[model samples]
Target: MEGKRVMAITGVHHAQITIPRGAEEQGRQYYCHLLGLPEIEKPESLKGRGGFWLQVGDRQVHVGTEDGVERSSTKAHLAYHVTDIMAWRQRLQEHGFQILDGVPIPGYERFETRDPFGNRLEFIQPLA
Candidate 1:
């Protein structure tokens, strides 16, 4: 116990997902306009770079710009806790986003989808 450092992670401050270079506007349209996430100003020091941030609940989601990576093939993703899953499904579908079913979990009902940039995302709701 003398040399061991105990690490306790309290909560997530933010999660970042990447989109291709120069696709920031499409990212904004899909995430902010279509998905209805509110945009937050990036710090002035970070503003010169491409991409933006979004506000989700009490957390910030950094949407960064990257190039040369295959976004669709990655299994990594962000899971957003949401209410009224059906409404969200309908809303995204109306905007031409496909709803993909995920594997069942014990106490959660969830589905997956891709942003226009092909970043994987999950919308999850707790079951009663």
Candidate 2:
């Protein structure tokens, strides 16, 4: 292995979350209007499937539509890093969304919430 090279891994390019059928508008309202993430266009080949793509900083969150699926917010979730934790928490509360407290993780403040379609999401801010 002296001359072997290991593959260099970079940051996440995108993460995909599923939404139930006919929930596109609700998804847009939450991910775009509330979260302030700009909606991006999907590839021409994939446009037939109903969904939305959103830009989160340098990364992307792809919300895809699935039919006939029961929605449940589980432990598996996507976590986004943010700057102001309290402000985000307030916003969620003001919007009538339930904020689930997260276990204390040193150097980070975090909370969990569910999207309109019951997709679990987490927001975190680094503590100095």
Candidate 3:
């Protein structure tokens, strides 16, 4: 027992989406406008690093800028629970965001959309 490892489960505290430096603008347009998240300024010290913070209710998502990293939808993703799926889809399309129609996630209805840097984002809402 002295070397035993313990796993703790508490709910998700926060999540960060990493994008290439200078791709923050695309994140702002797609996430802030389409998803209705408020953009909070990244600290001045972090400004030069190229990222922005978005406030999503009690959770915070930090979009960070990673230099020279190819955007890959296969690696990481963020799933958001949205109230209005159709409205969000329409708005995102109008803004020229590439959205992929996907099958429902079993217990939940969901779809996928890509950010400017190709980060895969999923929009989901429980089926009534």
TM-score of each: 0.90, 0.89, 0.79
Model 3 per-residue lDDT tens digits across residues 1-128: 48878898978777988877676777787678757799887788877877889988888899887877666628577888888788878878888877887775677777888887778888888888
RMSD of each: 2.4, 2.3, 3.3
Once model 1 is optimally superposed onto the true structure by TM-score, how far is the C-alpha of residue 12 displaced, in angstroms?
1.6
Ordered from best to worst lDDT, the candidate numbers read 1, 2, 3
- The C-alpha stretches of model 1 lying farther than 4 A from their native spots are 1-7
Runs in model 3 deviating more than 4 A are 1-7, 41-48, 73-75
**Model 2 C-alpha lDDT versus the unseen true structure:** 0.89
Q: Which lDDT tens digits does candidate 1 get at residues 1-128?
A: 58988899999899999999899999999889987899999999999898999999999999999999888999999998999999999998998889999999999999999988788999999998
User: Counting only residues 3 or more apart in sequence or on different chains, how many pairs clash (N, Cα, C under 3 Å) in candidate 1?
Assistant: 0
Q: What's the ranking of the predictions by TM-score, best on top?
A: 1, 2, 3
TM-score of 2: 0.89
For 2-39, candidate 2 gives per-residue lDDT tens digits of 88878987778999998987789988999999999999
